[model samples]
Structures are given as structure tokens and as C-alpha cells.
Target chain A: MGQEILAIIVIMTAVTYGARVLPFLLFRNKRISGVLKSFIELVPVALLAALVIPELILTPTNEFTFINPFLLTGICTFIFARRVSNLFLVVLFGMVVYWGFDKII
Target chain B: MRVKGFIYGLRQSVTIGIGYAPVALTFGILSLKSGLNILETGLMSMLVFAGASQFITIQLIGQGATIWVIGITTLIVNLRHILMSFSMIRFFPGISLGKLSLLAQGITDETFVLNSKLLEEIPTPEERSNVALGVNIGAFVSWVFFSFLGAWFGNRLNINFSGFDFALLALFIVLTIGTVNRQNITTYIIAGLLAVIFKIIIPGKIYLLLSVALAAAIGAFLQQKQLKQNKCQGENS
Candidate 1:
């Protein structure tokens, strides 16, 4: 079972690394348009939002809950993150608030 | 010059490495709890290195999904990195193909942001690549070490922590706030609203990719319009 899992990890890693590395190799000498370049630049931020919001909003039961502790903490974190540039403090604040809320309620 | 660039890169990498340790450690523990052995858990982190995708993959695997299903799901979840890699191509024009490929493998969200910002400060291609290499190696080392730490200490420690999952979400919120500027705020708002709306309507994992595409399209359209308007104003003036 462990070896099988290891095999799976190896396969997935190669696949993912290939996916990331192939593009750079293929497009190394090619010149892309400015418009396309701008569009690609927007991908990371959009992808980050997509990755984050759903997990925060959705309950384990699969129902959408807006007033959840996670969301509240996220909003607080977002606000603090804006005001504070330090990653450690921002994460610390969010974790404390989140843990406090979970314990209290 | 190469030595200096390498040193600077190493320093930046160490900072990112420290940042990634806790999260990867959590992933390691979660994988162990999911019935994976220490070796399997560490290999997963070392190989995949994608934080959210690995978490989701482990959760699915723990639920008894087949390997094929788990692999495909992880691939789809990590598809956004392909787009990220494309955006990063311009930064590595002068580097050798081998180094560029190695650097591309390390392009996580944190590394991408750090390298992009570093490029602004260090206009020289070598310096920028150094920062990218530094951040990547730092993150890679931290990920592997903490994951092992989590796996090794998994059985001994009973950490009954809840709400710690919000760390990633909180980090994203902080990053989003940091990245938004006056010109991009409108794009950000539109994307945020559209993502929430799609999350309501869409059924499953499709929402993740759909919202991203929609948001990027919206942002690109707005940016192009603004650029054209500026060009027109310049012509008229």
C-alpha cells in the first residue's frame, strides 16, 4: 500500500512538473502579444480568489453558509492584511480570532 | 555578480521557506491521519508541493477514492499554475533552458509574487532569476523538512486545533489586499462579486475554474478598454 501510494506521488509530481515546465520550454523563443500577456497577468489573482472563497463559504455538509466563523475571520483577516504588511502578524491575528471563535462558540 | 545574485536569491528563498513550513507540516499530519505512512506523506509533499491541491487530494484519498480519480482531480485543481507559468516566462529570457525549467517547477503563488516584486527592484535578468531560485529552493527545503517533522511527530502529538484551516484563506485575503491598486480595484471588485455569484450557481469543482476564467476575462476586458481610452485621449490631445 505504501509503495503504491509512493508510485502515485511520483506519477502526480512528474505530471504536474511536466505541465509547468513544458510551457516555458515550448514558448521560450516565442513572442506573445501584449494583450494576451496582460490577460495572463490577471490569471494568478483570479485563480487565488477562486481557490479561497469557495472553501471559506462552503460548509462540510455542502451547504452554503455566509455567516460562518471562517468567513468572519476571513473578513477580519482581509482587513488586517490590508493594513498590515507583515505576513506573520496577519496570519497570527487570523488564527487567534478563528481559534477563539471556535472555542467560544 | 553570479555569487551575489545567488546569495540574494538564497536569502529570499529562506524567507518563503519559513512561510511554507507550517502549512506543509499541517499537510503532512493530515496525510498521516489519512492512513498514509511517513514515507508516502513526505513524498506527496516533496513531489506535489501544491498546498491546497495536496490537502484536497488527501481528503479525497482518505474517503477511499481510486488513484486515477485522485490524480485527475489534483491535476485539474492545479491547472491554474499553467497560466501562472506562462506569465512568468518573460522573466527568464536570459537564463539557460535547464535553469529556467528548474525555476518554473518552483513557481508557487508565493514564489511568483516574490519573484515578480523582486524583478521590479532588480532589473537585471540574473538578479531576478537569483531571487526566483532563492525563493524556490527555500520553499522547497522548508516544505520537505516540516512535512517530515509533521509525519515523524504525528503519533506523539495530539493537537486538537480547529479553525487552523483558515490560515490559507487568511493569507489570500492579506495578499489580495496588498496586490490591489487604484487601477485594479474595479477589476478586483468585479471578480470578487462574480466569483461569489458563480459559487452560488455552479454545482461543484467547476466553479473554481469558471470563476477564475470569468474574473480574468472581466479584468482583461476592463484593462484593455482603459488602455484604449488612454491611447485615444493621447491621440486627441
Candidate 2:
């Protein structure tokens, strides 16, 4: 068990690191074009949206709904975030809203 | 100057560090229950440093998955970092390979978003490096420290941390809002719709990568067309 666990740890560490570092090494010499750079710049926005939207909209059982606590908090946070740039405040607001919804539903 | 930049980066990391505490602690507790010893649990957090993948790793182990299965799952789960690393290159021109390799180790989803958004506000390559390093190290240190604490004392702790997971989602919502503008609003909306759609039809983490790729490509094409149209309008005028 000991040796096997150690091997698993090493493999996970190496594989995760390899996934992250491969791109930086691969693109070292290549000069990215303007069009490509614009596309790349948008990746972060796209990635973030893709990451949070589904989780907010979908329940654990994969049912989609708009009135759930998560999505409601998401809407509240979006409105609050638009007005407030401070992340701490936005998060606090979200928690408060989520907690409120949790109590009701 | 370097210290100042690093400190600035650390300051930026405080929110994320706070956000990571409950999740990392949870990871530690779960890893131990899944049959990993304290040392093994801590080592996994120290080395893997990826939150979701680490959780997935332990769960798979509990299910008696093969090492190859765990390895492949970890790879696919973390493949998003490749796109992140590619996007990060624009900020660190002329950075040494050694430093880039070290930096890549810290490129989790949260840190990637944080650095990408905040690095633009900073001027000078050196300051950017300092801030980026600060955020990464700060997040790493907090994650490891909490994981160790959880492994050591998690069973004794009585506090319920279920609510704090909202902090991460909250952080992402704010960052997503921060990145959206008239120019890229279409991109943002498209990405969100596609992600929800893909998660239904596609399995695993591949849907995330696919949504980002297709949405960004569509967004970029639209932006380029807009630019070209403006150019033609100017020429006609």
C-alpha cells in the first residue's frame, strides 16, 4: 500500500505539472499573430464564464432551474458586482443572499 | 522594489487565500478518510496543488481505480491549465525558462484568473513577475498550510464549512463581471450558454475546454469582422 500510494502521488504530480507546463514550452519560439492573440486574450473571460455559469444554473442532480439559491445568489452578485468592484464585499453579499435563500427554500 | 511588487501580489492573494481555506481543509479531511495517511495526504496537496483534481484523485483511489486511470483523469481534469498557460505568455515576455517552469506549477484556475486580470494593471515586467509570483506562492502556502492543519486536527474541529464554498463561486462571478465589457460581452454570454449546454451533452471536463475554444473562436471572428468593417467605413468616408 505504501509503495503503491507513493507511485500514485508521483504520477499525479508529474501529469498535472506536465499539462500546465506543456503550452509555455511549446510556444516558446513561435510569435503569435494578432488575430490569434486576440483570441487568446478572450480565453480567460470565456473560461471563467464557462466555469461558473453551469454550476450556478444546475442542481447537483443536473436539473436546471433559475430560482435555486445558487443562481439567485449569482444574479444578486452580478448586480452587486457591477456596482461594487471590491471582491470581498461582492462575496459577502453573495453569501448573505445565498444564506437567505437557503433559509427560505 | 521587488519586495514591494511581491507584497502587492501577496495583497492581491489574500481574498483567494481566504477562499481556499475551507476547501483545502475539506480536502485534507476527505483524503485521510479515503485511506491515505497524514503524510500522504499532505504530500498530495503539496505536490498536486490542484483542488478539484486532488479531490477527484482521492475519490478515485477510494473506488480502487488503477494508477493509470488516476493519471489520465488528472491529466484531462487539468488540461484547462494549458490554455491558461498559453494566455499567460503575453504578460511575461523575456521571462526565463526556469522561472516560467516554476510559475507554471502554481497556475490553478483561481490564480490564473486573478493574475490574468490583475497583471494588466501593473506596469513593468519585473513588477508583473513579482505580483504573479506573490499570488501563486501566497495561494500555494495557504493551501498547503490548511491541508496540513486539516489532516492533523480535522476530526476534532466541529465547525461546519459547507457555506464557505460559495466564496469560490462568488469570486469567479466577480472576476467574470470584471472582465466583461461591450467589446467582449458577446463572448462572455456565448461562453456561459455553451458551457451549460455542453455540460448536459458531453461528459467529464472536456466540455469546459470545448466551450471555451468554440466561444472564443466565435467571439474573435466577430471582433475581427467589426474591426474590418470600421476600417472600410473610414476608407469610404
Candidate 3:
């Protein structure tokens, strides 16, 4: 099992490293299309939302629960995230609120 | 010269390292509970450096999923990094292949975010590389140390936690605010709505990849049309 795990880790590392390095190699000294550039620019924000929101809003039970602690904390974070602009504070606020709520309830 | 780069990397890494330590520690503990040894847990965290994919892979491994399935799922989940890497290629001009490969191991969401913003501000290839190196090394060291700590103390630590998972949610909120602009607001909304709708309809983990792909395609098409119209209007004027 240990050897198998090691092999898997090695393979994964290779695959991931290749993925990260390929773009730099391919695009070296090449001008990419403006349309494609714009698309790539938009990807991070779109991907971040796609990665996070659905998971945060949806509970493990597969039901849309409005009073869900995660959702409430997310709301507070969204409200404060824009105003505060401090990652540490925003994360702290959300985590503390959510943790407190979970413990209290 | 190398000392400057290394020092910059160390400083950036410390900030990101602190953030990753707790998260990776949790992952280490979880992996240990799933039957991995401390070394394996630490190795996984050190090599993968992608928290989400690592979590999913470990969870699947715990359920006795085949290695092939885990590999395919991780590849699909990590496809976003392709785009990320593509966006960041401009910063790699003078970097050596050996250094680049080592740095690639540390490219996570946080490092990508920090480096991208840093590039925009600094605009110097060398400085950008320094920041990337610094941030990644910092995150990597943190991840490794915390992962081992978690694995070491897995049994002793008992904090029943529920709400800390929302950090990603808060992160997205912050990202959304930063990226919103006059031109991209419509595209952002369309993409966001599509993702939500797809989440509701889709059955499993594939929705993340599918929604993002579909929305990006649509957003790109609209942006192209908008650029064309603006170009034509300018020509006519």
C-alpha cells in the first residue's frame, strides 16, 4: 500500500507539474488572440465563484436551507468583504460568526 | 541576485504559509484518519499543494476508489490551473527551467492570486518571479509543516468545527468585488447565474467544471461581439 501510494504520488506530481509548466512553454514569445486573452482574464473570477458558491450555499442534505450557518456567514462575508477589503478580517469575521452560531445552536 | 529573489520569496511565503498551515494540518489529520501514515499525508500535501483536489482525492481513496478514477478526477478538477498557468506565462521569460519546475509545485489558488496582482503592480519579469517564488515557497513550507503536525497529533486534537469551511465563500466574495468592472459585470452575472443553475440541476461533482466551461464560452462569445461592435463604431466615427 505504501509503495502504491508513493507511485500514485509520483505520477500525480508529474502530471500536475507538467500542466503548470506547459502554458509557459507554449506561449513563450507568442502573441495570443485578444478574444482568448479576455476569456482567460475572466476565468479566475468565474472559476473562483463556480468553485466556492455552490459548495457554500448547498448543505450536505441537498436541501436549500435559508438559515444555514454557512449561508448566513457567507452573506456577512460578502457584505463585509466589499467594505473591508482585508482578507484576514473578512475570513475571521465569517469563521467566528459561523463557528459561534454552530456552537450556540 | 538570487539572494534577493529568495528573500522576497521567503517573505511572501510566510504570509501565505501561515494561511495554509491550518488548512493543510486539517488535511493531514483527515488523511491519517483515512489510513494514510504521517509520511504519506505530508508527502501528499507537499506534492499536490492543491487543497481541494487533495481533499477530494483522499476522500475517494478512503472509499476504496481505484487509482485510475482518482487520477482522472484530479485531472479534471485541476484543469482550471491550465488557464491560470496560461494567464501567468508572461512572468516566466527569464526564469530557468529548473527553478520554474520547482516553483510550479507551489502554485495554488492563493499564490496565483498574489502573483497575478503582484505582476500587474510590478510589471518587471524578475520581480514577478521573485514574488512568485517567495509566495509559493512560503505556502509550501507551511503546508508541509502543518500537515505533519496534523498527522502527528491527529488523535489528540478534537475541535468539532462546522463553519470554517466558509473561508472559500468569503474568498469568492472578495474576488468578485475585486474583479467586477463596467465591461465585465454583465459577463460576471451571466457566468454566476449559470453556475448556480447548473449546480441545482447537475447530479454530482462534474458541475463545477461544466458550469465554468459553459459560462466561460458564453462570456467569451459575448465579449467578442462587444469588441467587434466597438471596433466598427470607432471605424465609422
**Can you rank all candidates by DockQ, best first?**
2, 3, 1
Docking quality tier of model 2: medium
Using lDDT as the measure, name the better of candidate 1 and candidate 3.
1
Q: Each model's interface RMSD (Å)?
A: 2.8, 1.7, 2.5
Predicted chain A of model 1: TM-score relative to the true chain A? 0.82
DockQ of each: 0.50, 0.69, 0.54
Return the top candidate by lDDT: 2
Give candidate 1's TM-score.
0.82
Q: Candidate 1 on B1-237: residue-level lDDT in tens?
A: 777787777775654565576677787788888888888887788778878778887888788888788788778767766777887777777678888888877877767765655565677777778777877877788888888888889557565766455665666666676566776666566666666777677644546556666777778888888899999999999
Best by TM-score: 2
How far does residue B205 in candidate 2 sit from its true spot (Å)?
A: 2.6
- lDDT tens digits, residue span B147-236, model 3: 999999956877666545555455556666777678666666666666677768875555665766666667778889988999999999
In model 3, which regions exceed 4 Å deviation?
Answer: B1-19, B91-94, B160-163, B200-204
Q: Tens digit of lDDT per residue, candidate 1, span A1-105?
A: 576677678767876787678778788857776567667667667766665666678776557788878888888888787778877677778878988777765
What lDDT score is found at residue A92 in candidate 3?
A: 68
Model 3 TM-score is: 0.86
Among the numbered candidates, top DockQ falls to 2
> What would the per-residue lDDT of candidate 2 be over residues B1-237, giving only the tens digit for each residue?
989989988887877888899888888899999999889988999899999889998999999999999999998888878888888888887778888888898898889888988998988766888899999999999899899888889999876534576787888988987788898889989999999998988767777888998898999999888889999999999
Better candidate by TM-score, 1 or 3: 3
lDDT of 1: 0.73
